[model samples]
Target: MRGFLASSIGVTCAAALALPLTLPTASHAAPSPTREAVPGSTQSLALDPLETSPGSTSTRAAGAPQEQGLTRRDVRPFSLVGVVWDDPDAQLHGNVQVRTRTTNTTRWSTWQDVETHNDDAPDLDTPERAAGGLHGATAPLWVGDSDGVEVRVKAEEPEAERAARPATLPKGLRLELVDPGEEPPQGSRAEGADTGVIPALDKKQTEDELIQARGGKSAAAGSRPFIGPRPRIITRKGWGANEKLRERKLGYTKTVKAAFIHHSASGNNYRCSQAPSVIRSIYRYHVKSSGWRDIGYNFLVDKCGNIYEGRAGGVAKPVMGAHTLGFNTNSTGIAVLGTFGSSKPRAAAVKAIARLTAWKLGLYGANPRGSTYLKSGGSNLYRKGKNVRLKVISGHRDGFATECPGRRLYNKLGSARSSSAHLQGR
Candidate 1:
């Protein structure tokens, strides 16, 4: 479904090693409403002149459904139009229309009415209308079967437009049709529920945090090549150490263009220190067991924020790492440790990620500020099904059908960008 909402831009990176990671803290709130809540009480009864008549008591059937209220007609199919802003509370008030072909007769049903308002609540405003033309000031949509219905939504207005009207939304807002029988959109949290903002980490802060968290000092010198001879064929250990390094016998060439982020998709309770061994097992499974050439990522980060050289990064040439899509030829992959959705990442881990990405972007000469770095067609940075805009840093879901980076880690993208911006300033 295509819907627009006023939103801000941000960044996301990958983490694939093992370690305890904590993301920047956020406030929590109740889940937003997917649709409007059902009303509990009926409207005040209007005294009918006929009901007060002497014999009217006999005419009023006690057990029958009330005809005085609205009634549902035959079901029809419809599509969603744009959602429009109605109030200051951020409560979304919008309309949806269904097109139907009943007995080969075509008809249009439009749902336009007001619902409750919420600036940052968890529930979406309920639909005021339905396919049967049943109308109410506010009515909850039936959650059971919406087989022939579609949905659309819009983003908030621009700053300039918002400044002028304060309460009005922009015109010609874009709407995306959500398919029937799908879950509704979620709402933002209420204010003051979470106080911490995800901020960018600078180089010094990153280094300091990593050092403290890992209980290890940084390499005193610049990066150097492995001292041993290049392997003719990568054994399981070789693949774990340098998965992307080509075997001269295999005739593989290095051509990385983009990086893809991913999560281990395992439970988050595992310790980060165990990641190396786990990665080694993964390599064995992929190569020795599955018969692939090497491991997947070019680099991996543990929960303690230590960066491990992987695949292409271990060699001088661009080694093909299974990171991103068509853009992998010019990319460097970095995977963080731990799942994000259920657990948060450590501040140290986020810092290390910023440092690494900053170094890599500078090496590639790619503008972190350019629109090209933002989400584009086929970018895999967010969830697999959603087309979330990507920053220079992206999540595993941004490109492929995998949940590589967990939500806790993915949530720090904005802070990563902020850190990148700070470096550019320096």
Candidate 2:
């Protein structure tokens, strides 16, 4: 096992040092030509200049410049949309809105806002952070099945002394249209009862699995630890994650000491049955469009309280994730599907958060209601190498200057922490 681990780490190091494997460069100077999403596949399309005027930059006010987006047009069928730019470090001080025409219908939805994720990213100097082709991106917005899209990005004016000047939009802005593709065929008499859902394990079964994961040897006398029952989880295969779309090597941390909660910020327009499709689309957007190693979160929950595995690593392992800027190490990220800025989070979803954290954090002997110190990798909130005290279960905004897991959701973390502790029997 040690040999295998060493070999895996070696591969991760080599891949990190290798060339930057970024998304294909696109020209954002003009309106992009129509593109198509291949059946059973995902696609990324760049937005062309929407301004009839010669420049990609337009003035919203005296000294305040704005960036134009693609003119409305028809394209291949897709179910999700987002915007990405050339530099991962650059911030888009702007507003992004998109409206799409439903497939085979004249009905065009109202323009919807895409949350600009200014700070959620991998730590500054890590291989994943420094990888070539990574881009600054907005939170992906799920748009269901559509063949037409229109987007607009307007820069907000700078604050204080710079109020007269318009904020600069990140360069190389492009539109990403993703088709989550078809759901995978269900398994017959497989691990998930042929329904794609991993059955929940009782307390004894979970302990046994934990023992097996720890080399199958019994613990020392009186050393058995308290643990929560393992909850049912939907597998990546169940969501039809195209393994080929992500990087071949998986990333890991030594241990998980914390869990960060987030909202997909992808809006609550989807049905519970469509949750798998939403996961697949975000997976594609994270890898194919955002140019990351994989989906940024370790686990995702639907509004119906169903848990779906995110990223490719084992669910029980401390898979390194990219969900929170400056604090991805030694922590897991749990994102509930949909925007919760104003919408109240569903009770089931919040309960699922507690249930997941109780079990996963219990495996590492962490008290979800307590606090721990983690060194910042560098963020707007903390400098690199600075150790900061954080709740064992925290919201995405706790570590970064962004509204994630949204307002209503963030407010619920206190109860989630208490419930998680209770589940762990602490």
Candidate 3:
């Protein structure tokens, strides 16, 4: 029944659904040109020619003008904010940060850095495969629950470095403010409604009935770790994913060998009930704006310990996703929603990651905490085609020099590993 429930969500129509038809129009416009769910109230302000300067600026060149890059001020009530820019050539050389004020408060926050080491584009060096829908971006930052905000991007390369560059600033800047909804949408996706739950024994009983359905293979293979029971996953349809915006045709690679973990980098200010709509907004941002074939992560986990399917292709299949950069091939990406730079990860979210990796990684008979060799497709950490032995369930930062999965979340990987291993009966 778990597998049936998971696959049942994918039984969508042949063509993609139109935007307005599926979207729930609340206070804001559809965040994406495609469908959007009324998960929360969010407003994305585009950077244009402004008459006044942004509230403040830092990390900029000495004596630099305030009009160096994009700026937005006096925004609506929001707890989280993210910056998006258009730089297809990756020529943008600068840092982007947002400062915000809490509701009914006069003080504003210090500018926090957004993660930018995300170059999830497929390596172009290999002639056999070329990247698709590549978009330049920086990870979103969490500013806690807030109301008013200001955003600025200082595009100042070192004076020495600017002398040899064409342009210092990234073009087309936009600030996205996300406010967690006070209540779940009346008709939100049913599957996501069951948040903070461990599936009933019927799910396990279903697993027993379908043992052969998952491919009967022993856990012993070349020193492989024991596999665990498949965890119940909320499907794209269950999360209200509009398939029309993404690639309809299925794409696949071979068997999964490793799993790389990531934080959605969107902030921790969201309610688990809003996860579906948040995911829909991300889907729109990725496909329509970011120019990616689909959402980057193969899977996404909510704070309530709910696991949602991400990317196209079957969840059980080795779907090729534009995640983990150089390690896209032979690996799967699992992203936990919300920022974790300073915030502590929820125990439920950690347990969900453990249950997920235990089953997904175990399919290949690999230990959750063990190391596995994956040839570097391309990464800043290793050269192309280098056979690097990475943790079977590795953090995104481990593969690339990124502050992804945040420092706080990264620190919790040991617990996640041990829990996953335990779930796998290690």
Candidate 4:
């Protein structure tokens, strides 16, 4: 079964770590829709199970079920795509890909792969998790500005003898089409009436934080790393977010002890002009369709190297986010806005990451190049309740059994950390 909404005003709407995390104070913001959300469309594609009946064309040998499951769906013009199957945590051992029509003419894009193993998520007991929302899902795929779309999911078979196919593919599959609206004119937020996400603090407040951080008096402890000066981050309001679709309150942990890195997994075909729309699309998808309180990452970086505030919590506070399963506690999740699996991460994107981390991590006195400890909440690699020590600036793959931040992008983490440390005066 599947659900779709087109250019409509409304719609619907991971991971764990042990070691009870203490939350800190929170601040919230409000924003109006930048443009009406792009019209929506929904699709459900039927997949052929592997090892067909005798005389049937099969992608796999007769007894191989792993190669059996496959599915795809086609939908009208939309900016973003998200896939949801029947179970939360149900693993689909396979590949997912999409190709789009770049022009009404015959021009078609080569197939693009969506990150399949996106298990990096917040702990189960969290509010978003308790809502019984997305247990398992593929990362959202962003195709360059396109009008037509299609997707395919194939079940993967492991080489090891011990690995076996589940009795069946996930029972239900749904595809969501999102139209992130047009880019707002530059400096739209300067108007008093601008409705994007509100800044967590006014200039006066931010100035005070800057003063405290520079003097190393914000959080004083021998073991505590010094907070670097706060970098300029575009607030949720700056991005023109719609506050109504999500629960408009802030959620926070006592302090951000770690910074988990991620790629939006939404493809690299977007223009900087389309960033706010991309964010809005992800925002609505995360809140309405995916059943989460808000966007999961604490901050988002664009390929153009622009930084946007993600989630509603004040940018200055320790807002808890639903990113990096088993390690969200005491951490901030920073997601770059496009897929990086097969492509190299943009240098601007990498620099934006370094600047953002240097400032945000500095607030808590964490060294971007150092390490932090977090317990596991049962990921593909970590058993529940296991104690894990991770780097202050780590990729999503370090904690979960998934290939996130992509190979090309993940390779750049070393540079990102070094740059961040340099920015923080480390």
Over 99-211, each residue of candidate 4 has an lDDT whose tens digit, in order, gives 77653545667887766666645576676577676646677877655666656656655556325533234656666666655555566555222333322333233334444
Superposed by TM-score, candidate 4 places the C-alpha of residue 5 at a distance from the truth, in angstroms, of: 39
Candidate 1 Cα lDDT to native: 0.35
Indicate which candidate wins on TM-score: 2
lDDT of each: 0.35, 0.77, 0.64, 0.66
Per-prediction CA RMSD (Å): 22.4, 8.4, 8.3, 8.4
TM-scores for the candidates: 0.38, 0.85, 0.72, 0.78
Model 4, CA-based lDDT: 0.66
* Model 4 poorest ten-residue lDDT run: 10-19
TM-score of 3: 0.72
64-86 in candidate 1: lDDT tens per residue? 11111112233332211112222
Q: Residue-wise lDDT of candidate 3 within 152-218, one digit each (tens)?
A: 6656555676566433456666676765434333444443313312232232342342343344433
Best by lDDT: 2
lDDT of 2 by residue, 224-338 (tens): 5556777888866667677767776666776778999999999999999899889988988888888898899999999999998897666766677888889998899999999
| Ten-residue region with minimum lDDT total, candidate 2 | 11-20
